[model samples]
Target: MKFQAEACTTSVGGPRWERRLAIERRRAENHARRGRRTFRLSRIFSLKTAVKLFLKLSRLQARGEANARRPIIRRVSFSFPNLPTSFDGFRILHLSDFHFDGEAARAVMIRDMLRGVESDLCVLTGDYLADYFDPLGRVYCNLATVLSGVRAQYGTVGILGNNDHSEFVQRFSDLGVRMLVNDGFELGIKGESIWIAGVDDPNTFECEDVAGAMRGASSGAFKLLLAHSPEVAREAVEADVHLYVCGHTHGGQMCVPVLGPLFLNASCPRRFGSGAWRYKTMQGYTTTGLGTSAIPARFNCPPEAAIIELRRAR
Candidate 1:
């Protein structure tokens, strides 16, 4: 039997081969350069930026985020003993925990929802941006569309939450929303007055000053406190606040049937963490909120913008 012998090219040193090798080398060099550049960036970056980058790159925005576009309006009314008779039936539109973080449809929904809403006052309780993914200072670019035409006779007031950067106060203020940082405002309505105060974020960063916010307001005066987290509820009530409003819990955004709250990052009691509850004489309300956080999808709990009416107790 005769076997055929096969010939193979042993010299890959031809001009064409040389050109191919050169191209391969360039690709390797580029890959190495990119890795080095990323290393340098990691070295100079703070933990915050690193975490944000990781979350943005690796996090999966869950489905049903579009459900976030249609928010329900929660209308709750309660009587306050000290609420002025003339101010009875005064309505407050509470918009909190927006978690805007650049979701266009949700932003547009907020804008449309408020178009037909009329209130004596408006309050924004924080978590303005979902996380660090959104570029700093751009949170309001879309929020302005929602807030511009909101009908509030007194004005809109805002406070920062754990998810917010300190500089956001001025940004919201620039958009005509009165941003209160550990401060108080005495608002007169119908010849009577109520004290509205806001505290800095106390849930994650712990910079709140409730006593400071209560300054200048009388002990017997009807007071409302705006906070980003219900964690501040105890502090506000201790400061002689008559009522408190906050968000951040998202009403257990995702809850198990009877077990409830897949996870609640807040320290407030579970019952008082979501809707209306009272501590001593102080009434507190926490909204499920208008948007989502971490993951855009919410299960069991639907998004909401709340309208709370204040009336005098008989």
Candidate 2:
């Protein structure tokens, strides 16, 4: 028996199926290539963005550190319209928050700052030493030397802060720095009388009785209240105080770039952060302070000693 030969047709359908398969393979390969390209571009963009952000952050940090190291001095002058003729232009050098701790360099810098100013009186607000450590002994000695060099026609008056202990107060007293703790004194200058009063820190220890402190003061005398914290401005105003000088918040210590003070523990309003403020008949001035505390750094808020030239208002 013989088998017959069968004819197979390679027609349009067969080639079309092969072409479709080839097209599908090429499409898949192209898709994969596009996906890899897209992934590579995304990675590059992310890396570039991250690098830019890191550089920006570095610059900002450098700027902040630079500002912290810079010392910015603020000068404020006030005029009392009804000031007595004899006390017309009495200038005062207000320095506060020394926070000294065996750092003779800081003390010398302070002395240099005060040496250039010409004032009738120098008022030291408080915080003579940073803490109750043994190093504070050296700090006190250096501070005493600096205090002895401070020149004022009237005198150098001071008060204590929360960080100060009884021993510190005694040391200050020995240095000819009069300690005014919840007490008032009268300064007679050219027949004109000015009541200088100091109140204890209201936040830390309890020694502030503003009313009682000013009870013995003459009613007609111009009242100048030296307080460590500005929170007592209400009591001072109630006692008819004309001027209030304080330095506790450290002008928020580390002020933010655009946001201002990072943190202010003050009881007063935020607007009174580190400058002169007026409320009713009372004028409150908060210094940026002379030294650092807590964190030994300051940003936009720099250490300062104020020269407040009081002029008679026309």
Candidate 3:
């Protein structure tokens, strides 16, 4: 009787142990499947993200190339009733946002476009290099070559942009581009002087000092301010700047046909993103600029070099 009971217990225990093993094995297999599924989902997500980013970048590049190929010149006329008679009919070639980078071909294209363009003075509002943060030596050389074609009687005067660095101020100066960092330059025509006061980039570096730049400006002198961003136009108005030139906003870089600038990337009104406007008594002009920013391409809004003809209003 004892042997039979022992045999029965062994049989029952053996089946129970096998059943437990089977249950655990199924759970392990299920866990493995879940882990594999999770990994695949994660990989797919990462791949999708990378592809999206690449596609967006490519699109911008395409747009940039297209804009570069078809360079446009905007001939604009501004009548300043208060403008000095000496500066009347004074034509300024306003070129801004020359974030020069990429292939040498781009520089060649710029040279071809500016072949016959003429101006009494050339004013580069800022952003000579496309990305100062990149390996900069090449960018510097590119700038010199690209701007070589730009000609003016009084030469080129520049102000720093948000993307610019402290070192570039001197570098640009060396290239015959007078970079004014909260400084002033006096232009004398037949003993009459016109003050060109420039402030550093007002947005990115926040180094602009309107009062400091205008320190030596004579009372009631023809004072013109060169600013990087039009965001500071209001401040210039308060400071009694007669004319303010800027170019940080790429005229909404990529604009929608009917809706206009989709992203102005500026604090001022969308209208100020490009073209001429007035802030109180101050006349302000913002350039669509010559090159793209953030990305290398543009859409709808083509790259342009602005020719501003200053006329004394009747």
* 1-314 per-residue lDDT for model 3 (tens digits): 01121221111113323443454466558767774235566655664346446647666556555765576889998887767788888888888887776557777777778878888888888887776445467656777776778767777777778666556766666677777777786777666677888787777656577877787888888788999889887778778898899998888776668988756667888878888888788888898888876555566888888999888899
In model 2, pairs of residues that clash are none
Please give the distance, in angstroms, between residue 271's alpha carbon in candidate 2 and its true position after superposition.
Answer: 1.9
TM-score for predicted model 1 compared with the true structure: 0.78
**Candidate closest to the true structure, highest lDDT:** 1
Residue 199 accuracy (lDDT) in model 1 = 79
User: Could you tell which candidate, 1 or 3, scores higher by lDDT?
Assistant: 1
Better of 2 and 3 by lDDT: 3
- Quick one: ranking by TM-score, best first? 3, 1, 2
TM-score per model over all chains: 0.78, 0.76, 0.79
Q: What lDDT score is found at residue 60 in candidate 2?
A: 59
Estimate, for each residue in 71-160, the C-alpha lDDT of model 1 and write its tens digit. Answer: 898899989777888789989899988887775666777788788888988889988887743566557777787786578887788887
Write candidate 2's Cα lDDT for 250-297 as tens digits: 898777688888666677787777889987898889998887765566
* lDDT to native, each model: 0.75, 0.71, 0.73
Candidate 3, residue 301: how far the Cα is off, in Å: 0.9
